[model samples]
Target: MNSFDLSIETYLSNIHFGHFATLSIQAIDNLYTFKGLVLIPVLWWMWFQQDECHEWRREMVLATLVSGIVALLVGRLLTHWLPFRVRPVYDTELHLRFASGEIKDAVLTNWSSFPSDHAMLWMAVATGIFLMSRRVGVLALLYTALFICLPRAYLGFHYPTDLLVGAAVGIAITLIMTRDAIRVRYATPVLRWTERHPAPAATLAFILCLQLVTQFDELRKLASGVMKHL
Candidate 1:
């Protein structure tokens, strides 16, 4: 809890956009809930667009997905290994002014907030898009900042540094994975298999995307329950 993170949270928590507070909060909530679904179309656009480098683009998409999962796993592992950091709302020192309609999640109260998986996962996807198309990638990054990361920060679910580190890790992994040599060596085989086994590939893709959309909430809940029984 450095002064920098505290300052940003303090400033954001204090301001409520008078007449638009409810509407703004609703919009942010919706963005958080549906962010993964929102990215699907953008990724589809990148994949299916008429381009000479069709195969490369397809390979890049697989690499991006792999990077996102890897980055998120790294972030979650760090949360468990590093000294636990509490979210701003849960920090007794902060006394954050809760946003209208933003109730704390009892389930997440004990979770470490040092590095946000949200930023890590989405930034990786955004970086991959940027690798393929600069214009759309820029928009994706901005949307991530404003819609995804900012909402979490304002609502006190994460500190600014958490988002920054997460984004850096995500972007670095994505950049490395999308390199031509790396994609050709790893992603190319996966793409070839998908081409050969279309039905099973589609089924698996649907499951993966479903997990992404829910941020693995169901899987986490099941794991938590199992741990309790043990």
Candidate 2:
């Protein structure tokens, strides 16, 4: 970690909100719940809303969702392929303070923290939303920054640089994936397929959304289990 990361971590650690620390921890723990509640509704509205450019909006949303999945895959691959960096919460040298003192049970002890997956996934989704609709997209970005990324730093799960790099990667990949040519070639066809097979498509979309909300935890666990025996 550089001086910037250390200074920021130190500053966050120094501030204590007393009993509010527990509440903050709870908020951090339950953040995934908010994902389905907030993002799913916004996505649903974005997909079905009637407007002059509704078709483009729907296609863009599809591209954005596809990009989100790709960004997450990239994040996971990078985390494993790159050097394993210790999380701030688990770093003994940092001696960071955990006001709630309950973080150990709540966080992943084994995962690397650099280029946070949370930032990559959510920021990509938010950037896509912003590209589709400025007003709602701004709200989504603000929510991701404050409610999603900030809490991870506050809880010492990630350094600021980790979030920054992950978000940059996410935004960049989404921008590329949602380009007119790419969307026309890929997302448009998928959208048309869904239109033709609404029942199965809806079921698969629901499953994918559930995975996004949970950060693919069960899927990862199952993959790990399968890999162990192979």
| True lDDT of residue 53, candidate 2 | 92
Local accuracy of candidate 1 as per-residue lDDT tens digits, 1-230: 68999889899888787657657755765554547777656876776777688888988888988888898788889989989888887777777774633566776687899798889989999899888889999999998887888888877788999999999998999999888878899899999999999999989987887787667778989998999999
Look at candidate 1 and tell me the lDDT of residue 26: 52
Clashes in model 1: which pairs? none
Q: Give me the overall lDDT of model 1.
A: 0.83
**lDDT (tens digit, per residue) of candidate 2 on 101-132:** 54565336778898898889989999999998
The lDDT of each candidate is 0.83, 0.84
Model 2: runs farther than 4 Å from truth?
A: 100-107
Worst 10 residues of 1 by lDDT: 25-34
Least well predicted 10-residue stretch by lDDT in candidate 2: 98-107
**CA RMSD per model (angstroms):** 1.9, 1.8
C-alpha lDDT (0 to 100) for residue 208 of candidate 1: 84
Residue 88 in model 2: shift from native, Å?
0.6
